[model samples]
Target: MKKSFTLAEVLITLGIIGVVAAMTLPSLIGNYKKIETVTMLKKAYSEISQALKMAEVDNEFMEEWNFTAFENPDERVHHFFDYYLKPYIGTLKVCEPLEVGCMSDKIQHLDGINERPHAAGKMSFITKSGYSVLFWIHGDGTGGHFIIDTNGPHRQPNTYGKDIFRFILTFKNSSNVYADTAGYSKGLKAFGAVDGVTREELTGGNVSHAGLKPNYGCKSGLMGLYCAALIIYDNWEMRNDYPR
Candidate 1:
């Protein structure tokens, strides 16, 4: 008498539950992915900014200084991963340090290593464009640079007209910049030689090659701009923290 529910009734209830899950699961997964991306970007930005501030405070000037300025961009890339990023993440096995021999003198090509790690344990550093972002410090004393894959068109995949986010920092005041029509050269001058204006104030909106789609950053609308703003904010906090 108490066992009144039939087999058909149980199956019907289970089917209804499954249908509800199927309808809502994809949306939940997509939102989780977005949150994960935002968190990683923020962590990467924080680590880089902290390293820059520490180096800047130790040195007495603020024109534009890159954490990796010793040799070519390739070598600097290895140094960045080995010294700065490794300390923050605390897992070297994930992103094996680049071999000394693989650090080439050439700045244009960045196929230096294979299967590099992008996020901590997530995707490998392989870009859809068959290239990866290369870290560099412009020959000038500026902060640093983010070079895009030059093998293919500079925009995101399938959007030929869109621009990539290539950034240059002015060590003078930590201004973030995009590439100009004459390539990064024009952007370089705008950072170091602008005269009277700080690097923070020298950024321009008209840079052609440095454009990217909107909503690229987790907090802001664009990743490059978000990175630039975070760098400046972190630097200020560092100054206050140390108060030299």
Candidate 2:
């Protein structure tokens, strides 16, 4: 006789299934979110790179522009972004420098718990692609730096290396920059550094920042600035082996 299961048996079996799901569901969900973030990051990088190439075509020879010659740094920022970035990129709204709604009020580290106000003189705006960008020109013609919130400020966990990432506008040939060849400043590079974390091997494991920690992007007081390069080093995919 194909008898049906008793009530208690069915309840127990269902309870076991629930327990197993409880054990694994959160992790699976978290991993999916991480993958989503990675996708957004790669998309942001590609868009910005394409814009840069266009900017190069529009403004012939960045090597000749002398933004460094400007006295007031703000003027340099205005000129560079207006001419180079504003024209080529799609900015839906230009936040009045640090005006509210431009970006997240606080920038945090990747420790995943610490929350603090980012005390820095910066300016940002919203892009049509749904990213918040903090742009700064060193007032030198070599190009500047960009801090991007890949998912925009609307999303949570707005932590560095999570929703936020940093990149440089380098004129120098950044190819083959892996290992110690990160002579970023030796040539006409951009931002605070030329090469990113790919220089880990050659510099005795040093990123753009001194004594940088591995997989530590935007953490430890932004010491993890090279973390994106670290991700790219891992083939543009975040693996379980990557730092949390």
Best by TM-score: 2
For model 2, residues 1-244, the per-residue Cα lDDT tens digits are 8999999999999999999999999989979887887787777778777776677788866555567677776677777777777887788777655465767877766554554323233467788888888766664355566777888877876776677777766554434433222335422221234344344431125444543344444334444555566556667766674546
Candidate 2 residue 145 C-alpha distance from true site, Å: 1.1
Distance (Å) between predicted and true CA of 37, model 2? 0.8
* Collision pairs in model 1: 63-171, 63-172, 64-171, 64-172, 163-211, 175-199
- Residues 1-244, candidate 1: write the lDDT tens digits: 5878899999999999999999999868855643443343344444445655554455544443354445555455555445443444322123223422111222221112222212221111223323333344443334455432222222223110011223353455332442311222222221112223233322222222233222322122223322233223344221212111
Q: Kindly report which residue stretches of model 2 are placed more than 4 angstroms away from their true locations once superposed.
A: 111-121, 173-182, 185-222
Maximum-lDDT candidate = 2
Which consecutive 10 residues in model 2 have the weakest lDDT in total?
Answer: 186-195
**Candidate 1: segments with Cα more than 4 A from true spot:** 1-3, 64-134, 147-168, 173-244
